[model samples]
Target: MSAPDPKTPDDDPLVTQARLRRERHERWLREGDMSIGRRLAQIGVLGWIFVAPTLAGLFIGRWLDARHGTGIFWSAPLMLLGLCLGGWSAWKWMNSR
Candidate 1:
């Protein structure tokens, strides 16, 4: 009798499915356009990215004011700085591929 044909796991149906999925992902990356869900997720991420630093600055400034017995002097400046920095960061992130 003839011998059986040799085959690798790459020939399996599961492997074929996985390969197709990977190809689709690569195509999506190349196209650089995402679905609405992805856009919404990106917005959420960007919002957090902008808000985190502002919140952190506010907390730190508040702590400093409490420790130094100062008014909103420190807090106001720091908060504004944080706002500018966050805006800059978010802008860069949005522009990046």
Candidate 2:
């Protein structure tokens, strides 16, 4: 890249300064995007997302099991498995993004 025209700075000094600051801040944020707390929160959120269906199944299955007498025989477990699969899928999706 060509050196900055120090003699005249950029065509717009304020715009240049803002651009430089934004780049620097982005670098800093990227460097620290994931800390222990952040990681824990991420895990918590992912778990919640994954388990939502499971919990819903538990309730709905229980209700249906009582109404239909199936005991949610498969829904609960299936939903639990979905939790893990959902998390894995999310990871894959994020990586692709």
Candidate 3:
């Protein structure tokens, strides 16, 4: 096979710049420098994670109240417990990284 062509600084500027930009982006991703949009999305995910269990508890408690004829007695405590559990779960997720 013939020898490969030598590369020089005189390479096309556009190609060089594109390659450099790609490298920089790869480095940023590797370094875990998430973009603002991505960070916001993650925050949204965390918010959902924190809210789902609480809402579920509320609904379930409401069902129990309807069944057992109890007022806020069951709903209130369950809601609080769900809130605490969700908060703990979210905290663990946030800190796990």
Candidate 4:
């Protein structure tokens, strides 16, 4: 293999400055990607807020079933409905934002 040539005037200060600025601009474009963890946390908070009441109702119904053992099943559909509605709301909110 041949030895490489020494640096030339093509490597002048103005050229170097332009190259540095281009690199910085590209770096910013790469780093501007959204954080998946942050998005997931926002969705989780949405789900929690929307689903809390249904889950609480489920729990209370289950507790009441300590006497009858039937109210618990009655709450299952509510839980599922809550999950669907909450997920829809979360997706809508995220997409809107």
Candidate 5:
């Protein structure tokens, strides 16, 4: 007769989720709640992350349009591209935290 394989309890999804939740709760208790100032700072940083790339794209697009005399053609597309880049960057930053 073949011996039965041993199953690891930690491999279960529910067990993993409970473990994560407990760790997070412990960390929160250890660190205390986030201050209002800290939250505001985080918000500011997120805004800057989303805005900087967009403004850069707009400025560059404007310069290109002016140099090539293409009216608003380049500016519009570049601005949209910049907005997308900024949004993606902000999303990634949020997820990392």
Candidate 6:
């Protein structure tokens, strides 16, 4: 009788699971886990990514309001726009990782 091919979809599920696990283990051994400090640094970067643009928007809006004497009209919308932009940027950055 001919032996079953391991590469075939009909191969044993347990054997497939074991092979996947072994591959994952080998990959983990090659690339170590993320350190606590590295994780914290990533968090900080994300925070800045979200905050910097928002703050810049607020300041610029305020400046424009001061120039035109609009009294919060420009400031409010600009700040909201900044918030949306920052949020979108942060979301994209997170997804890329």
* lDDT against the true structure, each candidate: 0.89, 0.71, 0.88, 0.73, 0.94, 0.90
What digit string (tens of lDDT, one per residue) describes model 2 on residues 1-97?
Answer: 9977565546778889899889878988888556799879877876776677567756665676678777668567766766666677667746653
Off-target runs (Cα >4 Å) in candidate 1 are 1-33
Candidate 1 residue pairs in backbone clash = none
Best by TM-score: 5
What is the TM-score (0 to 1) of candidate 4? 0.41
Q: Over 4 Å off in model 3, which ranges?
A: 1-29
Q: Give the TM-score of candidate 5.
A: 0.83
Q: Candidate 3: global Cα-lDDT?
A: 0.88
Worst 10 residues of 6 by lDDT: 3-12
For residues 1-97, write the lDDT of model 1, one tens digit per residue: 9999988898899999999889889999899777899999999999988998898888889999999999886798888888888999999999774
Candidate 3 lDDT, 1-97, residue by residue in tens: 9999887765979888989889888998889777899999999999998998899889888889989999987898888888988999999999775
How many residue pairs clash in model 5?
Answer: 0
* lDDT at residue 20 of model 5 (Cα atoms): 88
Task: Sort the predicted structures by lDDT, highest score first.
Answer: 5, 6, 1, 3, 4, 2
TM-score of 1: 0.65
Q: What TM-score does structure 3 among the candidates reach?
A: 0.67
Task: List clashing residue pairs in candidate 6.
Answer: none
Please list the Cα RMSD from the true structure of every candidate, rounded to 1 decimal place: 10.5, 10.6, 12.5, 13.8, 2.8, 7.4
Q: State the RMSD for candidate 2.
A: 10.6
Write one digit per residue (lDDT tens) for candidate 4, span 1-97.
Answer: 9999877766788888888789878987988866899888886788686787568756665666766777567577666776676667767776665
Clashes of 6: 0
The per-prediction tally of clashing pairs is 0, 0, 0, 0, 0, 0
| Best prediction by lDDT | 5
Task: Return the lDDT, model 2, position 11.
Answer: 72
User: What C-alpha root-mean-square deviation, in Å, does candidate 3 show against the real structure?
Assistant: 12.5
